[model samples]
Target: MIIGIPQSRAFKWSYRAYVTLFFIYLALPLATVCAFAFNDSVFPSLPWEGFTWDWFFGTEAPYIGVFHESPILRSLVTSGVVAFWVSVLAVFVGTCNAFLFVRHEFRGKAILYVLMLLPLIIPGIILGISILVFSSSVANFLEDATGLWFDGLRPGLILVVLGQFSFITTFATLVISARLQKFDPSLEEAALNLGATHWGAVREVTLPFLYPAMAAAGVVAVLMSFENFNTTLMLVGSDAPLTITMYDRLKLGSTPVLNAVSLLLIVVSALLGLVSLLLQKRKD
Candidate 1:
């Protein structure tokens, strides 16, 4: 006896197999890196020299976890602080843009949206260079006129922020736009009819409705800022963010300590997401 297949069923089975292979191809490397991150080896190689958190706790190694180093810890803290602000700034401004684009009708709105999205389409390296040059030019011009030098123009923390914010805001805008498009206009109408002021209605109903999307967009902005390199490279002044510090470490030769750093970063990001999830659960 033969177990048979129809043409359509066979096609579906084959297509499903292809999709499974595609995802495995994409995910296998990340999974491997995560595994290697826990390895006790001196480098990112695989013969399974055995699992160890020695690097994590600085139990044994030349490159004790960066967490034990003051300068590296400083850079990580600086990056965290900057990323947090960028997330807040992006969400605040982007959510407003989304509300305007989705709820308000005005002249040249289509043209305006195209402009808002342009930065996201631009290459990050180019964006970084452009912001550096443009800010420096303005800073120089201002100094020439008034002899007041603004250090923020120098590729540093402020410039890194300004650069990251450019594209991150666009991301936040898109996320909020997606949420806004799905918003129920009738809810707003109903609230207004119930003697709620427009501001009150928006503050209570609209803001709460958009809160989760805002939080997600904010997380994306923070992740982008934390992992940022090109723009940070061009814009960082005398100091470095964690990404830049890691790049510098790699230039001197990479070790499993870098993997330790990456693993710690992954854990921190996961914890942040977990905190958000818990807050959302509480709200629910």
Candidate 2:
């Protein structure tokens, strides 16, 4: 009995130790990055340089903060705009697709559904290339056939939006459709038997129930759009997104400024997560 008790205690201690080490492994790099953001050194790597707020809050020329860095700030604004529009468009299209796939059955439905989901499995790089090539071909064909110029066909914000939407909308559709499938068809039938029209029944009954799923899907869409790099790299033009801008800076030669940007993003992401958790808890 004494041996068994000791063995159990040893197992518990070992489990806790493993968990602690795992967390430390995950957090060490992030902690290092945050620490170096405030380091007085120009480079992000450190030899224990004295602390300074130059990276985050410097008011002077070379030591400009993230908010004061015009190029980074512009890139951030571009990212925000792209993410916002992507989320809105993805949600609208994906919700419609969910309804189409889940609520109705038609000929070639299986093939169409497979085609829609194909984007999810395709590599981002390949998908980006395909989109660019197809767009260019279509643009050329239209010019040759109709002789009418489609000015928005070039590699720019429109192309980026379309490229990101290809996969993001698929993700949203899967989320909303999963929730939609769980809904009972009898509710709609009951509403129809009463005085409700089809649109009215959908708006009044199914939509309210689907709100939570749609909200979650929208959040996912926005986050994915904001962080997407591979597809955006191909589609972005002179006006670059945050990820592309960061990549360019890294290639040129990284500075503590990158660390500062990382820190701000980490804090903002944490706050967003906390707010989302609180909202979910309140809803529960």
Candidate 3:
């Protein structure tokens, strides 16, 4: 039997064309970047000189690969560290938020939920600027009053993690909350009836159910934190993340090393996404 609505030949061809073009639009740039990553030429663009592993492994002056480039490697490490903290914090806070919103009712619950989403609604640059200004002000006031500087409040990796956490936690909360909504309350009740304490019930029944979502949320948070640019740029101090470092390098000039970095990121992101899908499928 026929499934979807019957369409005219013209409509079918048009739909196919649209899908083809859409995929081309999406994949062409990435394909170009990946291609240039192996190009022998120093420039990332055009006239494929020849294939070479220089961009990935060369340690020569002009052919310094991403692995060999100390600055890029340092930035990669910095990004990893920031992403780790952001993921941890986002997942923990998000799990708590999921529990709070799903299992409890309180005054102004709706308002509070809306407020929690404000960070996502605001522009990233605006959010970064606001956090920077507010934190600087607070730091200044504290320093004046206490006559001691608080480096944590300055624009640094800590602030970058916090800024990213502000929005990433919302995503984590939404993911975990969606999973929580599907959970059976009777399971927890049954656990309690079986002599489990409240916390024990949650730990045994609810948390196991939420494990997949929490893991997926953590993956998303890591990817988001690693790739975040606008917010990280504002909050970053001496230790720059990969995105900021790439931006700085691009401002100077484009190179195949950057393309190699992009390719690596794309592969890593795809793997994380696959892991998320596997987790979600396991939950199902």
Candidate that would win on lDDT:
3
TM-score of each: 0.84, 0.87, 0.96
Best-first order by TM-score: 3, 2, 1
- For model 2, the stretches where C-alpha displacement exceeds 4 angstroms are 1-16, 145-149, 271-284
- Model 1 earns a TM-score of 0.84
User: Over all chains combined, what TM-score does candidate 2 have?
Assistant: 0.87
Collision pairs in model 2 = none
Q: Per-residue lDDT tens digits of candidate 2, residues 42-114? A: 7888597899888887878677778678899999999889988898898899889999999789999999999
Q: Per-residue lDDT for 158-261 in model 3, tens only?
A: 99999999899999999999999999999999999999999999998899999999999999999999889989988999999999999998999978999999
What is the alpha-carbon RMSD of candidate 1 to the true structure? 4.1
lDDT of 1 at 188: 88
What local distance difference test score does each model get?
0.83, 0.86, 0.93
Superior by TM-score: candidate 2 or candidate 3: 3
Q: What lDDT does candidate 1 reach at residue 264?
A: 78
Q: RMSD of model 2, in Å?
A: 3.3
